[model samples]
Target: MKRFKHLLPVLLLLMSLTAAIISCKKGGDDPTPTPTPAQPVTTITSISPATAPVGSTIAIGGTNFGTSPTSNTVTIGGVVATIVSVTDTQIVVVVPTGAANGPVSVTAGGQTAQSQSTFTVYVAPLKPVVEISGTTFANQNWTRDKIYLLKGLVYIPADFTLTIEAGTVIKGAAPDQDPDKKNMAGTLIIERRAKIIAQGTASQPIVFTSAKAAGQRAYGDWGGLVLIGKAAMNTTSTAALPGGVRGTVERYAEFNDNSGTLRYVRIEYAGAAQPTGSATRLSGLSLYGVGNSTVIDHVQVSYSGSDSFAWFGGTANLKNLVAYRSFDDDWSADWGYVGNVQFGVAVRDPDVADQSGSNGLELENYDPTATTDVTPVVLANGLQQTAPVFANLSSFGFGTTPTTNKSAKGTGAYLAGLYLRRNAAVAVYNSLLYGYPEGVSLGATGATPGVTNNTIDLQGIVLANVLTPVVGNGVLTSDLTTTYFTTSGRANQIVQSSDLTALRLNNFNATTPGFLPQSGSSLLTGAVTGGKLANSFFTPTTFRGAFGTDDWTTGWTNFFPQNTDYDR
Candidate 1:
């Protein structure tokens, strides 16, 4: 009986286990109902804007992205990206910080899709960046902590204001490396009526530089800063000058219209040329149709591939400008620029010059500087003449000492101090120009800008070491230089090169040379506030050629940007 009882307990245990198994089979084991069909593989077809900097929005186009944004997850370079919007076929996501170069991946409905092509991510800022591209529709403020990398032709449309904090650094990314980008440079264009309130302090000047590293930076690494406004210009079409970049046009004139403020700013290693067919390279700061109300002061342009500063059809007044080692002209004005410039300096390198001839002021009314510019008899569209007043300019071109090859890339000829051709009506007072082929090369048959006409006025000038003080370059014979420029009450002096030695500008030929006038030098004397300088636009100063005892370009200017740690 006891044995039977033990067997009965064992049998009861087996029967209980069998019953549990049968119940489970009936409840949950119903033929493993047709397996839920695998989710459609999320296929990535394309990625628009394949290249992007950190903190930029990019589109991921594909299929199988769920309609709800929460259901989809996107990652760039393995870093999680914020999904801005999502659709079944497309997903828009903002490239998050810390993103690196990698393939983009998206996950939706338990299915995943990855891009076959690698996404290029650029982050060349000191710490981080907010990249700017295309056109700025809304008002934006750029801070100083992060360097803004301009990806393409960044435009600030009219009425939109770009407020830049002091000490901000903006880099123009070179587009020559990427064949997909259309433009060869990253340019900043302030369209007509657009405003840029960039008022930097002397200690913390705004800097616009190339994206290359310190040692790798060179001339034309990227594009320059351009300001286009509404102001009177000499040309009917204003297409002659490159103020609107390569082939863009300058629109109707609106005198005294404000563009914006550019004070205590530095634009370094700029002036990159346009794509293939462009004949002209961009300038460091090109003002097109800018108005006098736009303030431009204490601006330094160093290592420019082309001109440091250029104006086309504008009345924009600029002062305290420094043009250091430019490839082309230091200052250029054309297409009826009637602005006022004072307290400017041009430091030329005998080793650096352009094929078109590098000079201090390359003045012209339009593109054609030949005798075809006989419009001196009649103005274009009844606009004002190109009569910009320049005062206290020290254009020191030491061309005699080294006897340079002139051009950086190819062989080029040494030009002049002020090459005034075409129909230019300019007025210069209290300036020093030295060490070129000629101090002032006057050409093109023009009656309005001639000395007899009084429109081409040179009130006070110190001409030294030039092969010819004043000469008609090829077409025009300047009778005024022999009879009026030297003999008249213009206070113009033709000093010998030895006089500059007493100035004590030690090692002025070097890359980082001293440029302060010593005590008892003749260049420090003979400044006047009479004649054309009597106008209110002129700031009355006792010193003559741009500097006397103080070097205004000391703290803010970077003479050796080749080695500067811009990221610091």
Candidate 2:
């Protein structure tokens, strides 16, 4: 039994070894089974915003998009979309132009998948733009099919003409804030003997504005327009033309020179866009030696960073002029301007003013820096003092509450409705001045003969909500009230009333302003009877203000330009 037991242990160990060899066998008869390859899982689960305009970005959620953006190719509506970013499960892309309604597809790695839903693409309505720069040496015509973009200063040389069609839009390029870009602010200068025939209708007035996105436009976005001509100018002293344009006496200017016509035009953000960084200051519209043959009517200048309208030594006449939200003076006439203007309105902003004083009308004749005093006729230039005439003007200043002068100014000049200085020999009739520190200012610039010698006459002047009816330096209030304002023939009154009661304007909102006078308003009556209305230059009407029932600013004027999406 002992011998058999010993043999059984050896036989058990041998059987175990044989079984291990059999279990670990890797021979050809039992070769390893071939491994199966895994299938790719590239897919597009969902696409956000089934429909979008071209250039709009959208996101797509899926599986196996891969981490590398270069390996992913996304297409919307069969158009290849630019992949903005990519992740393993989501991809963001910008819709491509000319894309149509089709499935959103994404090809990742070696596999491609598409979203179940289709993506619709639409075209956004946009205005086509044309850029213009430098000088205009030849006659040019601007049409309405496209918007013209003015880049930097544009000059019209002598003998050239620029014809702007009705409903045409001219936009100034964005101010190149970089100091390296000098004189890059958009400006138009019509040199002497040059002409600009921009005659628009009331239904489709031409528009000049800033080329900026909506809500980003402001005063001084670009430079303004200037017109110079060979018109007669009587100046004994230095003249400050619009945008610092100077009047020369190299030759006698003709009185009958035809400058051009500008009617039914709206200028927005057209003024000194202060490029304190590099460029010169600008004005809304500057006329240097412009003659009476030039036609300017129904023109609105809004958001001017400098003077709205300035005429230096010329017999240029204008009617139906509107100055809104100007940062400086509205109407500035200097250096013997002997023209006639009627039906003008100036509305001031409560928040803005100029550093050189803000006034509705700033009239001057001679510069004190040039000469001490002047006679009517001077031998040097055969020049006389300023003697322009104006009627039916409305100047709305600060609110009834006293203004705190939010703006700065040199010369310590105060805010006034009318500023007459430096022997300004002129006349104003049937004018309305409202809401100002001084309704009529005189002698502030050391004037002597104009107010006292009866050269400067003001008749039918209606002042409402004015702090002071007549105020100036070195002038008695009683003398001004009794001599000029309270005469029997003149109908001048200083009353305290609101805009709704005195003018009854339809709308006075800052952005969308309306200056038409309605019924039950004081502006409907009390016009000059026979004094200046009998003149050929004046429109014979009983209305005391610029507007009477007829809304002159209805059709083409855009008061809400701040919210207008011009490029969209």
Candidate 3:
């Protein structure tokens, strides 16, 4: 039919070119496949506080968290926190000072997300509640899981240091009963060249109580620990320390002034009384003029109303001292304290006294009619006149009788058990004055020319159950115990407390007693052995007085400071 009309226009142009190649492959193939973005899954699912503390601020929540907090990150416990605010379902960070306890990831876009459990980072068994006060001078540490909080006269001034780490606990406050605010006492003053590392061990010590609250605490309730150094003093000129109480004068630091370390410390229920004069108090450690590189070992001044480790002038050389239950004077030195103590331990509580008479070592010098006159201040300060060289002392009093009826005329008016008097120049070795009424008083009745020119050295002492073992005001009577057992060099006993019941102490009026010393004890063989304490700050212990068969005041001494729990 003539090729069927030429193939009917070529079959209609090949079916219109196959319908234009199927309409250009159904409208240009595959250039629109770019809608697949949904991979940003950074989930965390709730993290409000699962513990949080290292500078707290948690709150993580859930989901993507990547609307763009710079595409988010977070970490925590792997540390990197500090992200403040992020969105896409919340983020808020900051728990990174050393963020410890684990998993809290949360990446974003790159997709990370951890938190399902394990966050727990609030480790402060005490920290936070820092407070302090005034003058500092930078470098101040205090960490052992902090408690700090002094709040009044906290000064450190003159080239500061103040470290304090080993299990610290500070606390102070309370005591503004407004006697014009009583100098606002909460004291910590270190002044002078200021320094106080406060090392502590014997199982973590460093405490300092009185934020009152634990049997409502007592005794002055705060304001104590004052250091103030410059080494030499015998009144006059360094503003005559003592009642003039000058601490921050700003110079003088010699006698080996390194003013730092104080190992295994504990000073509970501090002093606080000095608002103005009279028996001017403030002590449980007030070492003005501290030096000799200042270390002071294993200290513990408990329940002191005043004077329990005082030293208006210092050469600073204490060692394992522990004066518990002191109202006043359990080791007090004055105007010219040339230090060197060793293993001291005083325990007294016949219902506390302190009308200027509580004694167990209350030395003094520099006041031959003061206004600065101790012979031109010891001939223009070559110093060394308030002597202070006790060794291995262990004084425990209150036992003439009365377990608690109290007043044996106010405990025989200030229970003297080693009082040494105003023109003092002491040195007692291997001591152990027990259960006293009076056992070693000397001069002080108008001082008697400083008891005929100072020098009261007693050796290897052991006056027990003393009613009056050596009194001397009409100038050293009983011939000063026959000149302290024939010229102060050999043994010197006066036993009677039931011939010294092996001194297993345990109840010198309880409250954690147990001043050790029992297995065949004659104080473990009358100490003072051959090499007589071979110097180098004497540590030669054949056993005598201040405990010797272990028990260096056991696990950081805190004889139930009114049931301790200074915020745990």
Candidate 4:
């Protein structure tokens, strides 16, 4: 009976265990189920030729490319991309044609791969090459599709010739704000030993002017025309041709006897400034220490703010130079310019001028310590004077600068007709000095040495309505010359006192005509050159005054006069 009881207990235990196992099995068999394989995601990875040409073939890379996308498809920009070929993990697409040289992108299966906006198609510019050989301009037809740039001190190779077609405009560049960088506008530096055969006739004369429009034109609009030659000039340095060529400013080593020729050419406003403190200020034409081998004839410099022509101590010969309405001194040569000039004229503006405005010529030696080697700048057959004497000198007297002394006169040394100071020794003859506050004042600074051996042989010279006598210590005149201290030619005259505190003179207006030499204006006939009169002064036969002849009035006009203010 006990064994039977133990067996029953065992059976009950076994049945309970079985019931627990069944419960666990029932819980495991609930409604939850595992998922089947999912559809793969589509995406774009990369593009080739990060920067490709417009017509180049490009490739696109990506994964899970669809055959016919319903909501998302591969595209570039907004245009749907044509899938040349597609695989399970990649898609090949050709770049679109006629695409701009800008950024490109690839979009596939709602994913995008982009190239930045700065990225562009690569295309090289076709540069026009110029090859000069055998001392002659060989590439005559090279400028067809090219622009010329005279970069970084270009040496006009010796025995090399540069011939440009008519009506060609060349711009200059110089580092203004930054000399180290490309700050300079442009510059054409004609170095020593280099010859340029730039010839222009009167009928079809060559023009060198600013690129700006007439109304907006200005002086120093661009860099100046720097001609470096081995010439003689009046300067303090014992060495000839003081300022050297290019960056080397020294005495001339070998005197170049080949005089550069410039005829029937008109250079408009030029004279762009270079680096700060640079001696260059953009004179219409800058002759840096050239020699007598240079010839400047039949050239017109109009509306230039600076001196029309600046010679830095060179022995160049000038014939028929016209200075029409230059703001500063008409002709400036210093540092030993021992050159000879004939048939030169200076014209002044009644208005639209500055205190620095001068009628005839100015010469000087900026250096105070250099040894003296004086060479006289000779001038003949010219009318060197201010316009007409305005009764009210207020309008014409140094027009603007209150501090400027209109009554001052000298060889540019003091202030007037022939100002020769800073030890500058110059000689002048057969020129008229009229309508000046002071005829001639010499030795500006008490310490500054006066002009030595300088002669002014004024034959039939007219001195009309001047503040002071034409015969100053600086002016050495003979009996043949007439000096009228108190005289009047064209009315409306004014005079200032020595105190220089008040303005004096009479009704000077815009309409007041300066000295206008008539066609038969006595000055037309009597010009004794070397000794014999030349038929061509500026045009046909020596005419009169500074601009003895007129080329524009005859058949041409519309010369782009330079602006008085080059910087503005």
Which structure among the candidates has the greatest lDDT?
Answer: 1
Give the Å error, residue 165, model 2: 0.9
How high is each candidate's TM-score?
0.73, 0.72, 0.31, 0.53
Residues 1-568, model 3: lDDT tens digits: 9989978998999999999999989988667767878665667888887886776688889987887667887887787887878779988887887678988988887778898788988764644677786676698888866588786567777787989888888978764732335466676877777788899887778898888778988876887788877777666564534432444333353778877888889998888765556665678788887888888898899887887888876678888889987787788887777768889888877767766567788776756543221431242364546766778889887656423234443342465677765556676777888877777776543433443443555667777777767767544566754565545456777777667665555555557677777677777667774433455787777666777676678778877788666664
Candidate 4 lDDT by residue in tens digits, 270-332: 655554343445577777766666666667776665677887766566765666556566677
The sequence of per-residue lDDT tens digits that candidate 1 reaches over residues 300-378 is 9988988999897778888899999888899998877888899998888777788888898888865464454333423
Give candidate 4 regions above 4 Å deviation: 1-157, 173-182, 232-245, 253-256, 350-359, 365-415, 433-435, 444-460, 469-516, 519-568
User: Of models 2 and 4, which has the larger TM-score?
Assistant: 2
What are the candidates' C-alpha RMSDs?
19.3, 15.8, 22.0, 22.0
Candidate no. 1 TM-score: 0.73
Predicted model with the maximum TM-score: 1
Q: Which residue segments of model 1 deviate by more than 4 Å?
A: 1-125, 177-180, 238-251, 367-382, 399-409, 446-449, 502-506, 509-511
Model 2 misplaced stretches (Cα beyond 4 Å): 1-125, 174-181, 234-249, 273-280, 369-382, 407-414, 444-448, 475-478, 497-507
Q: State in Å the error of residue 411, model 1.
A: 2.9
Decreasing lDDT order of the candidates: 1, 2, 3, 4
* Residues forming the 10-long window of minimal summed lDDT in candidate 3: 370-379
C-alpha lDDT of residue 472 in model 2 = 52
**What RMSD does model 1 have?**
19.3
